[model samples]
Target: MNDGGFSALVVLDDLAAPRFSPGAAELLALMDSVADACPLDSAALHAQASAELGLGDFGPRDYEERLEVLLAAYRDAPRLSRAGRVNLHAQFLQLLKNRLLFTDLLRREPGIAGIELAPPVVIAGLPRTGTTHLLQLLAATGRFRTLPYWEGLEPFPLPGEAGVVPEPRRERTQAAVALMNDAMPHFARMHEMADADHVHEEIALLASDFSTMYFETLTEVPAWQEYYAGHDQAPHYRYLRLHLQALQHLRPGPAGAGRWLLKSPQHLEQLPVLAETFPGATVVITHRDPVHVVTSMATMVAYTDRMFSDPTDPAGTGRRWAARIERMLDALQRDRSALPPDRAVDLPFADLMADQLGAVERILAMAGERFDAAARSGAEAYLAGHAAGHLGRVDYRPELVGLDPDDLRRRFASYERRFLPSEEPLPVDN
Candidate 1:
């Protein structure tokens, strides 16, 4: 069931992993030589990052719990090329570094803990269902505040940006982006990132705590997934509140910025947690056909997995994700039924693409914000300036990934009937 390149990658992985991702023959040999080296000395990594950042506090060592899980995955991931191992190791260190930096800043400035947050307007639903597009439009309304991509990547300010000198953090973020774009240009085509792009999701912030699907999607880490399957995200949600407040305090936007606009497909899986953390926050849920959603997600995850892994199993990967998505849909249905009517609104993928401005107007009304002519025009201008689905045509066949369209539809039948096209009921008549 795997696609064209799957077997070739697997066959070459153990001996020539660099052939797939690294692209350099010598690096492949080096990877073989270093494959047996120790991975991610957590204490040493933490100490080094702390010294580098000149910060000692790591808030609570609660995140330490995830370190062992990551180490386990690093050890078990098969045919992990030197490049893949190196990248994964670097990411963990960076996450640790971010935790130290953010915690130190928050600890030094106690007032950051008290900054009140506008009840967020969160976008949730299936991947490829216009959540990012909707979030960007909502942010363009200028009525809401969101983090810049760089801020999302590096949430804390450098030591002295209030001075006249240039901030080194910006330069660092830019350089990193450039390197990534150069190294993996195709990834940008699918999920482009830049120095100042709007916050796509809180994934990076969640990664700092290692509580999201950040690692699972990037690699075939079934053990971590199994562990996370039973874990509670309440602590992560609490940390998210603190994290948002820190971003707001460091980069204060307009006096009356409407609210914090957030989006992530992960939200659908944990809607109750979000509701509990930010009570009274407005939620927007997007719906698309399950067949398309499942297949597209598998392909995207496979791309990322291959980048950070080797000998990727397309069939197994797709099967695991398909099952996960089915569970998410089931959870979504239960949560939506339990939610208060005024708390959330459903937006169908068809409606958003067919008339984005109309969808935005409906969203604005749901958020209790005015959608005046200017606001309508702003949303229109946002769409006019930016092409939708800039990833071009994606043709991921469900069968190609071992997923049956009928099975996906059957699994999501109840959800589709309630929220998908022809059944979606928007309160607004716009």
Candidate 2:
């Protein structure tokens, strides 16, 4: 996805795979020009990572295991571009730096451990379902402090770094975004981002734990994916809380009191753990027809993977991601009763987009929060000034990704009956 300081991808046409711009192509060729070692040496990489961060106790020993799997992926994956390799390396270094710096902060300032968080406001949904749009609206209210793109990229400051000074990574992030956009112009249509973009994904912070959906977005590594699935993600969520506390301690919230406003598609399946990590969290789950969810998400993944692959599997992407979404739905359904009724709410994408502020008001009301005049006015202004970015009216056929409408409908039948009864029914033939 977005490498270094940014993350994500989409845009489609007549081919099984999208074409790279000439500049992007030339850049990839140059990256391939000077070949180096394959399957980067894990020990050497760790040593380099250690040196990169001024050498600290990188906390738990678990991340190194993930590093091995990732290195194996780079070495084995065929047709990976040189630029793709460079991006992956940059991402790994960032994660290691995050782990070192974050742990160092906690060790030196145990008071950071005491930084209290109100039950956070979490926006959960399938991708492209107005989740990001909602977070932006809420963030504009100036009532919550969100995880900005820069914080997620680095997550913590250096050993003795603090103050309201200019961001240390500001120039580097802008340069990276420029280079990425300059090479692949289509990126803007996929998911727009900048160095200071607010309401960033939680997956970026998960990378510090070396357990994240970020890797899944970048490549097709079944072993790694399987390993991730089998493990207990509660530990990762535990680390997630620590990182959030660290962020709050580093940059005191608005007026010395504001909750964390976090969003991610990955949260759909981890609701239980999320609830455990932050008790009484106000969780908002957004729904869209699974048919749209699968195909669109596949396109997003297609764009990012294409940077690292050629002849990517659109249909396979469809099938795998479709299954994953359905599984998440199933998990949510199973755990629905476990969540506190007053603390949870559901919003349909169509409704949220139609009246974004109203939908948020409904959500806040359910969480026992007030939608004050200031919030209403701020959201109205945000909507008046900004519009959803244009994604041209190009067709995205489900069959192209090997998905059958009826089959997907059956797969998501329970989800529909539970949360989308009044919504548009899936187009399926008996």
Candidate 3:
């Protein structure tokens, strides 16, 4: 709420001025059409739209003015690429519809003690430290319920039994997968995705509030990123918990199943806050050489940028990523000291890969849980099925991405010394 501390907060008054580029206008128009069809609550709709547009506290008067400008732009714009525009519009509409419905349900049923969410496990680490793979692997164990991409995106009105059939969801997911493959085939090689596979960082849910690091990665908008960088990410975590509660209530899982397994690289930067929110939660910290992490992360960012824009700048990606990782390391260090020793577990990427089963067994042990043979075998089968080739398919050079390998290594020297195995180099590229 206090703008002084956050580098990313924008006074709502300033954001009231309409500043839509041609491309942004086109996108906004799509969103408008979708929202119109869905017909969400006006106040909630405005809040959602404001967040999407990255408009901070312009107060009530400014909110109306800004919304008018945005609506006018959509009304005046000519139809764009039908396929792309329609898809974007539909996605936003669906998102708004779900959020509004969920919010209404929560309000109406204030007494609803949603299905209890417990035994929480949070997978957190620097980007490209194998956090994604680890999450998918853990999800496959069947001991935990992970928020699938589809469910996470649409967490309202309770998905019906007809929707439970995996076919429709799988088909939709496959289509999106095909599009991504067509657009950026290189990414699939690095990260294998299936319709049922677990995804990381439900940022879209957080994006509903415009307070997320995801905005930075989506656009080359430094001003917006700077505003978010300084703000507290704790609210997003709170939103996550509420949604998880809603999801559990809507879709009860197997009897006595533990709480949701949530994974996100962003969680690393808000470790202390996350611990405070979920005190009993099990936290798994993944570690890897900083240099390799940067390189791998830059490549992934480069690939993602290509999907939405032209001319992905690898160096710019690396620099932004480096800054974020730096913040995360700082947070982790501070939180590690504050948290009880038993609540946290540190793991090496290399060790996890070398013996996936053993690594997971130890992790579960640390969390005070035991894995049944079926869960263990399921995890093993998942690893064998996914394979290592899927793990870092995109070979990237730190130097090519404008990263000085030595400098990066030096920057994370303290982290390496404290967490990395003695035999491993502080910033080993490979």
Candidate 4:
């Protein structure tokens, strides 16, 4: 059941003013010296990944320019702590390594390219719009291939790990999750991260192509953001599809299984590319009040920013995401018609909260999937085990995040009127 703001569970630490543990702070400070020694150089990182993986090819060279642009943006990122720089370097290097592994797999098994993919059920929506819950419920139905968090971290296994029991990828991901929980203790309240087996978006696949909004979560990089905005993402979307094909080829499930179930807030602005990439896909666009979305998003981003930077600015986060979301909405308003009406479903957040199972039924129906007894039972079990707000709560202060409720409502009035009319009272997360 949904916890609509009134929960006896512990309220999480304040995001407006994050308090780091003395031990954690000392560890971070110690890591800074080691991190400062590693610079964010694209060429060096590429060469390192090549040397480590014993692979010379990284698929296509088209992504090199974008990687270069992102590195330069990281160089210009403001107030980026040494630890943050270290994190960025590690992340980029891992992405490069993943690319190498993927390209190598494609090279070894040329037949992988011939593997056909079923039309996926894609969820496109902003953060805080119940997209994660919807994806989890659908995945529980055992009706689609979903990417687990561990797989998202490293899609391909290391050399000599094929056919190995108890994947090392999962164990490594579990360790990373523990470290992240210690660093950002309250993040689970805002976004679920308690388990490595949880469902994750395909944004990581997009990052392999060096074209995604995942970087912004670490810290603001307007230069990279601008570059990302100016590029055509269809090729990257194709790259994502190639990886999906590879994953399916690497691990072929029982014959005649369901389609892939995927979700990403990034797709809210890339509906056209999504449609073009996955023809005949079931596109579900979840809707919520923009004011509430912005406030919640701002708080979460600001909270996560503390891990990478000291003294995060909540107001700046609020303002930046507010504008960023507005641009997404504008793009949605412009490109929504790109999706065929029969294959698209509009899901309001209030309706999802009001009838979670019912929403699943509707979404499944839209995707031409049956809501069998097994599916319902699985979904019910998932809901029972994963109640909202069970991980505690966070006090969302819009004022502290430089958000005015009235002004926000007015700013998003057009979007509200278009998608969530006044008749449907929006549920408040509080």
Candidate 5:
């Protein structure tokens, strides 16, 4: 545990160390008890826990131990609060429901196969650099099969006739959508999220192991970020491939429809490993001014933290994001040579935003696929329906997000020269 580098801030009070609310503590205890009784393999347990926590494949290792400590502290603490208790109860209920659903699915379909995700055309980039909008645009082409939010949540039951009807699964997605609106009504404006037809990252499948970067943003815990950044995520993709096969097995695809279109910033760090695993895979890497990326991502992280935790600090969040991006970029620079030329393509954020249709054409062209007139029309329709101003509104200045603009420019000078020399430098307020 000492070597694990679980920061004192994660476990202490705001001024002292990281402090857990009583509800968070109680939820931890309930999970620990389940883990103790299940006696399952680590990966299986992780998968099960991920389903339960709504954490979406991002359950931490030593999850049991962490739970026990929180539970014990909650029980012993003299100042246990009502809000803490209520929060814990809600979390526990959700976890229980997830575990039951996951277990039942495994029992019903023994030896389930994973999705045969064809070589994906992945979009990787720094946050707030037009990656999301690009993915959504690409998904509209109909040539790519994106794992929609609904299917990702209910991967056990293949979406088919059931998908056509207003089923419980559909209801769940609607409920989630409603909750999102309640939590962050403004999010949809910055980046739209829907159940049925959007391209999403496969990171949640990796999150089952708590090794993904999703958790760091959800909770402003520096220790968690440090531990997550250094971990090898190559194995998670293997697991993801298996799950995809399993889900796809249930719903056979129309012939010639391309495999999943995945997107995630975390992929930058694991690019080499990803290439090795899926040699045939085509990758689309997005580039932006590192300073702009850092600042915008910090704003995103701060907003996300507010949804799940207390005492979100914009400065602290910015610092952690800067460090993580630096590491990811460094890894990308080191591993660039490992990727074959034809398999990789880099697109600048400014260029993509300026000419999204052209960008999509180039990306598909690189993959040796031509979008038919119908596909092109579909892409246009999607873009028209889900316009830029519809979701996930973000307006952030570098200074507001605690970044030193001049320093960032110098740090990412080489990257700018190589990938974005022609684009205007992101506006920075002194």
Candidate 6:
């Protein structure tokens, strides 16, 4: 893949070709051979979760329908390889255990439901549109309650796991992070990640409800996507609020911890739901040229797809993600008015890249939070430690994904006109 005039730093100069390392290949082979042991059957998964957690109640039976539908889709999915099945089964089981743990916690401590939550500040945008970086900067300010990547993996601590030293949850997450980095070294270059304390999207919480775009990230699942699109996600969004409350109750933060800071691309398509779930939230929408978004997203998808499926279809990934972005943009444009004008902030990619602290200050102002000395110090520290492109840079070419820049520009014309700056020059396709 050729660089599309986006980055100059080349820390990984030897990675001219895109292929999985030998270690990764061997690991995938082992996983494929053991695929039969990790069945994708919903019944088997539910039993395993209950057995593991010693909890039987799954909160509500409504989620069962969604789970069944998802499992069926996975079973019938054409492109899902054996390794994909094993990996997805593990993810599915973890979510099942998460659901069980939450239900058990709520049953024991009914007060968790009564815990009031302050309105959150949410960042809504597509991937590669400065969402992750903005989330990190704001989180660094130490003014808002945010979900860590480790907590997102397992929201509820396992039974008898409270007040323990070193935090078992964090240790497990660190191991997982190391394994992923070893398997896909270039991932951090495209999207930076951390072990315990990195800011993560609430999309992980939404996964317990079995209604999120996260599933589609693994491989092509058109039926699951169609099913997800047909349903109203308001209930699931409310479920996400409940998860947040439980998290707050489990680990009580400072007095102002009620005001959560959240970001997720899923929020782009669920603007109305987000507004309903967390009223008076400061909604920040980040804008970038759809061409750049599609190119970078397709490249990341193909790179990660090696762990599950073989013979990456960059062209198909580009087409699917382009359509997905189009739908999210349409939903955003239509329902943006759902949020009050006073609580809305539109941040262009160029502006954020040009002056990150300025963008953070603007967002904090919109959220009615002061950009005081502490906030400034934290933001500056984060900037110094995690400079952009520090991990390295990947040269993403639209042609590698069979994407035509002109066509993408035409397709996203209305969105660009509405949100992006008119004077922003078109990105060159090398």
* Candidate achieving the largest lDDT: 4
Report RMSD (Å) for each prediction in the order shown.
5.4, 4.7, 10.7, 2.8, 9.5, 3.1
* Candidate 1: regions farther than 4 A off: 1-38, 160-167, 421-430
lDDT of 4 by residue, 182-270 (tens): 77766777788768898899999889899998887778889999999998889989989988999887776434355788999999899
lDDT of 6 by residue, 146-245 (tens): 8989999999889889877798998899888988887887777788886667889999999989999999898888888999999999999989999999
Candidate 2 residue-wise lDDT, 224-250, digit = tens: 777777877898988888888888877
lDDT of 1 by residue, 146-165 (tens): 87777777777656554324
TM-score per candidate, in order?
0.86, 0.89, 0.75, 0.95, 0.74, 0.94
lDDT of 3: 0.61
Steric clash pairs (candidate 4): none
Between 1 and 3, whose TM-score is larger?
1
Candidate 3 Cα deviation (angstroms), residue 73:
17
Candidate 6 residue spans exceeding 4 A from truth: 1-18, 254-257, 425-430
Error of 4 at 232 (Å): 0.7
**Distance from true position, residue 397, model 5, in Å?**
2.2
Which is the winner by lDDT between candidate 2 and candidate 5?
Answer: 2
| Cα error, candidate 3, residue 177 (Å) | 2.2
Q: Give candidate 2's error at residue 331 in angstroms.
A: 1.1
| Candidate 4 ranges beyond 4 A from true positions | 1-17, 253-256, 423-430
Worst 10 residues of 4 by lDDT: 1-10
- Superior candidate under TM-score, 1 versus 5: 1
lDDT at 289 for candidate 1? 72
Candidate 3: tens digits of C-alpha lDDT, residues 1-430: 1123212222211111223345555554665456444432335555664565343333223224323333233333332223333443444445555555556667766654454668588888877777878888877777776777666655553334335556455456566665555544345544555454446456666654445566455425555555556667776677667777766776665553566778877778777778877778888889998778877776566555543333346667778788778777977877776556787888888777778788788777766767888778879898787766533333466665678988898898888888984654333121
Q: Report the number of backbone clashes for model 5.
A: 31
TM-score pick, better of 2 and 5: 2
Clashing pairs in 2: 2-6, 2-7, 2-8
